[model samples]
Target: MSVSPGIDRTTLRTTVAVLVGGIAVILDSTIVSVALHQLAQDLDVGVSTIQWVSTAYLLALGVVMPTVGWLQSRLGAKRLWLAALTVFLLGSVLCSFAWNADSLIAFRVVQGVGGGAMLPLMTTIVMQAAGGHNLGKLMSVVALPTAIGPILGPVIGGLILGVGDWRWLFWVNVPLCVAGILLAWRLIPADEPGRRVRLDIVGLLLLSPALVGLLFGLSNVAREGGFGHPDVLLPLVGGALLLTAFVLWALRRGGEALVDLAVLRSRPTWSATALLFLTGASLYGAMLLLPLYWQQVRGTDALGAGLLLIPQGVGSLVSRVVAARLLDKVSPRTVAVAGFALVGVATVPFALAGADTPIWLLLAALLVRGLGMGMVVIPLMAVAFVGLERPEVPHASILTRIAQQVGGSVGVALLAVILATAATSKGSITSAFDIAFWCATGFTALAVLLAFALPSRVGLDASAGGGTPATGAPPGPAADATEVGKRASIAS
Candidate 1:
């Protein structure tokens, strides 16, 4: 089962297969961002109704993510993933045939359920197969969609919309899905299913509704004047209380509850999760700023704006190899602190750029910002797993992903609020853009503080995290409990 050293053939093949599938999910998630307007018109619905398409997908995804650890243990990775892919494909087909906004949004729920399962499962599968080694390089391979999605999704959506129709966006997923299924079948390992364990039905019900209500509250806050509105306040407060309840319930269960919160006691886990939130704020905040700045201030069309983003994507892709290598050799703290500093510095140019700023200069700033982004994402992810047990990896993966997704939503909402208020008083698109850029800079600066929380030095073993001493699992009815406990110990 040992993979050979230095990008072994089997590892490379498996990594590529997993990543190809990942690209489809990530791409589809973001592609709809650029197509919403077109979709509303084609379906003859108001923009408000069309908004449900993305929201439903996001809500469904968030609800399902925390369940992934249990699903993998019970269903096995291959079966769960293949079932997810089948659901997603069917959803895509349904979406393409939708005659109304409501139908499309409803179908997107199906897609989201499938999509939600795939992301964490992909991370769990790929990282586990790497045997808790070479996390940096493997993350780089996996990080492709995060970097490329912003570029590809918008551009592809714009191109397809310009030449044909909004349905083409869904159409694009077909070929990729087919290829992914085949590659997954051929390359992914088919381990025997694990023994059945008690499913936390109560914990899942509590968590999912809480997450949806929270996200809904936040979205409503963005829409209905302010957070003080009853619609916003009720759900937001209720959701927070529910989440708190889940936490208490989980802790009372002695860490065997849904999320395994005990793992947060691990310094690496806490630090990594914190950095994940900051990274989400910075990365997603900047993504919002660049495009709006181009279209609103510089008057670039959708395609032109997408073209301007190319340098940023290129910078991210180029940095991956270097960042991956540096992570294995350098201290995670040192790498992350420097990365945030670079991101903060790069934001200054955009914050100060005028409508007349030269294209080349803007592109250069994006390239620098993108490099910092890659550095932040890859290392933050790599350092988070350091000293984790194999079993805890899935839980950690789910938490990090959830944190980032929520952070992104917050970042976008905050920026939107800022831009809205600023535009009224500032009186110019450039002014709004500059104000938002400064906000983004602040987010990156905060990331530096979180980065310092990571281990000050590297080269730590996966099983050597600073926390409670390791303990074997309590006896369970299932035969696989021992195996699960060993894996969970490493991750915990």
Candidate 2:
């Protein structure tokens, strides 16, 4: 049989099953970011109360991630995923019917609870099923929601708000969740629950509150008095102390810790997690800045800004197949370096962009920026799992995701602070944005140097249960890969 040049059938089906349900969670974020004003007005609430709509979800997500490994071992992947999906569906329905501000905020916590578990578990399940094969290709598939959600969410939100009923935002998730449930039930292979792991109650007490405090603090950074504000400073300091304590506690426990800090000992795992933090900060900072430039500088509405950002998303989509194919030829270091270079170079156009910059020119740069953004995640994930055991994959997923999310909040907070300060100093909104974009570009440039730390052409010893991460191109198709796909097709 001729070898296929993509993810095999079994993996593809599982990917689809997870992504169908997962897309709504991601889209919900960007979609809601655009609709905050509308929500505040419709709910008859102030900015602080409505801000919780987003902040509550983020903190809830952070709180649940550190415990995902224990949850998966206790509940099994299939059941946990189903339960999470069902809860998210229920939350969406409740949110649609919410009559008051408090009701919506409370219902949002329900969504966040379900969403928090879903994000990391989605990766753990898919990575386990992929079984350490063709990971670069797999990430291109795995990273789909990340790529498309930012692209489509705003556009969808704009269209929905255009309909004048804010509740449709929640209603929109119903059909997707229903389809995801049916597909997951039918397509994902079933597995017996693993041996029950003892819960790390102390670690949970330290870490969950640590994440919540830090994120909640950062969420307040863009507002009055910046980081020095009492609300921002207090949570940040408290979060840091708690996080430091959790690190010490986790070190003492090793594999027994709630999050298994031992995974960071591997070269690939630590490097990828650190690099993902930088990229997450940069990418998310840029995501925040791009639409703002259009709205504030160019005078376009949210919908028009969303429409223009499509080329970047398209560029990311175009790069996946090529980047996956390239991993078969070069080290992940090469791909990462090249990708960061594209991101850094592409960002230059934005730093230089003025109110009068040609629309077509900016659009072209977005396409390149997207290509680079797309390439970064592939190698980070491809490298991270290189030396991990099946059990270790869940911990690594939880760790990397938390790092990225924290990094994202950090990025948004830092950049927002900078923009506010910049705007005040010169009263030149244009110059303030230019400075912020340049800083965004600086973050990507740092990532390029760090990319060199990623292990290149590392050879895996499959003799042990742990395989070398597929960092180099494989010699050819493994004897079992096609057979696995065939079996998967037949079974489903």
Q: Residue-wise lDDT of candidate 2 within 1-492, one digit each (tens)?
A: 333365567666777899999887888777877888788888888876788888878888988888888888877787788989999999999999999988988898898888999988888777777767767777888888888887888899899999769999888889988998999888777755665778999999999999999998988887668889999999999999999999999999987889998889989899999998998788887887888788778999889988989998888887887788788788889998999999999999989989999989999999999999888888887788787777788888888889889888887777777777777775787888898889999989999999999988753211111333221111110000111111111211
TM-score of each: 0.91, 0.92
Scored against the true structure, residue 76 in model 2 reaches a CA lDDT of 78
Residue 349 of model 2: what lDDT? 91
| Model 2 segments more than 4 A misplaced | 1-6, 459-492
Model 2: lDDT to the true structure: 0.80
Candidate 1: TM-score? 0.91
Score each candidate by Cα lDDT. 0.73, 0.80
| TM-score leader | 2
Top candidate by lDDT: 2
Off by over 4 Å in 1: 1-5, 460-492
- Range of the 10 consecutive residues with the lowest summed lDDT in candidate 1: 475-484
